[model samples]
Target: MATLARLQARSASVARQYYYRNSVVDVFRKKENDAAVKIQSWFRGCRVRAYIRYLHRAATVIQKRWRGYLGRQHYQLIVKLAYYTMKMNLYNAMAVRIQRRWRGYKIRKYCFNYYYLKAYLKAVSETNEAVREALEEFADMKEREERKADLEKEEKKRDYQARKTHYLLSTKQIPGVYNSPFRKEPDPRELRLQKAKPLTHPRPKVTPKRSASLRNWLECTRARSFPRSAVLPPIDRKPCQGPFRDIAEVLAQRYKPLEPTLRVAEPIDGPKEARAELQRQEWTRNVQDKLFLPFSSYHKSKKHIPAMHLSSKYGPDSYGSQHFREKNPERWICDKDFQTVLPSFDLFSEYGKLYSKAGQIV
Candidate 1:
């Protein structure tokens, strides 16, 4: 019963103190009332002195009430604050336990893994050591064989030198190889000796036959020794001269017919089949209408064989195709009879005036 009454009284006291402090702070803050009070105090000095004394007493009470309020609030919050602190401490302790257990588990796993790796490494090291020992033994055996070969070679070289000296001194002619282990010229020595011809003249028995055209081509391509000022043979010239004509006429003349201008007649969104058919027709027209070349369209009735590398740039890494073809003639078949088979200038001219139009011969 006494504790309950004390609790009620304590709460009421805290409320009264909080309200009283608020009212005092409010009164102190009012500028108008404060100025009026100060004016009135100047007029009534004794009453103003008594009011000042009362105000002093109220300020002391307010201060004491504020201190008591703070103490009571602190006392009330202690249980809750302690509860939160205990909760936080418990959480921290549990987290630490979990972290320690996890760390222990990880450490144990890591140790097991490390042991497994160490065992595997030891096994590998043992295998490597065995292989290394075997390799060492093999290397020693090889060294011994190599040493034996070296000794034998030295002895053979000494014996050969002695034989060579004796043969040179006695017969005054270097003897042929006698039971030599080392390599000599004309590799299979016996057959080379059996079929040996005199070394004085090294003359071949049969002369190689060659095609005249191939020979001429080879001679033309190959470098020949001559006086520096000597004239080289020129490429074959045109057999006949071109008919005399104005340069403007020759340049302006077109060998191929001018293509007719195409026009879109209407905004026609045709079906797939119709568009495909139109594309096919266009392709056929393009194929039928020959593309003109300066040489082939004007001179040859037949179309010129377009060079595959006409537009492509050949870098220095690749050899010129013309030179490659001329050098490797076995890649082609040649006629021995026709040494000068190329046409002359008469082929291009049809008896005088140059025709601007092409013939549909091809």
Candidate 2:
């Protein structure tokens, strides 16, 4: 019985240990499964975070690209609008100018016709008045001549009667001498009488009808408008007198030309050299007279004219005169001569295009 009881206790102990080991393994398995689930959850969270970050980055890039595209499109639209506006303005200005020119033409025609008729009538009236005055002076001279002739006749009649009475009374007393009193021998002091004729002054000649008429017309007419102050004086400008005459005489003497001499320089070796030398000499000579002479030769052999070399010295400014520049500053004179000598340049090309556009607008 003791042996049987000991074997039973040993079997019970083995079974209890096996049960305890099985329970411990189940608990460990449950713990491992919980840890795996936590790890999977962490991986899913990380994947979601990575996806969100990628989406944010992609959205930012798309927004920037869209903004840039819109900006560029807006700029292009603005430029197109400005260009159309400028073109419209230019067309309107040209239309206005054409209308103004037409109106000016009509007004000028009316003014010229009205003044011409008025001037002609005034000239005719002045001529008539001058003729009337000349006729009156001639009539007065004829009347004076008739009165003087009547007075001379009366004096001669009185002298003849007195001489006849004295001759009749003294004839018998002086028979041998035969001194007749009618012949004025009775009184020596009153023997002969002399009469003087009246003197008449000459009348001035009347002026020609055409000359007087034109003069009156010009004086009555209004002066025409001109753009510049350097205008010619009236056609009736008279010779200066007194102090003004002296001043004019002095100026004439001062401005008189002095003796001039022309001397040729040595002949150049080539046609180009000769032309260059001639231009330089001509420029020097003209400087003394305060004149500027631009040299341009069409000769095939002559290539060194100052015009050909203009780009080297004065750049594009040498294209035209200062007056042309003042009127159209944006326009440049572009020629073969200018382009050939001009240095290769990007800045000038851009500027030249802008200038050409502005020139076309003007």
Q: What is the C-alpha RMSD of each candidate to the true structure, in Å?
A: 30.5, 45.5
TM-score versus the correct structure, for each prediction: 0.20, 0.25
Clashes found in each candidate (C-alpha, N, C closer than 3 A)? 0, 0
Tell me the lDDT of candidate 2.
Answer: 0.58
Instruction: Please give the distance, in angstroms, between residue 114's alpha carbon in candidate 1 and its true position after superposition.
Output: 6.1
Mind sharing the TM-score for model 2?
Answer: 0.25
Worst 10 residues of 1 by lDDT: 259-268
- In order, what lDDT does every prediction score? 0.60, 0.58
Candidate 2, residues 45-125, lDDT tens digits: the string is 999999999999999999999999999999999999999999999999999999899888977866557767788999998
Candidate of highest TM-score: 2
Q: Quote model 1's TM-score.
A: 0.20
Best-matching candidate per lDDT: 1
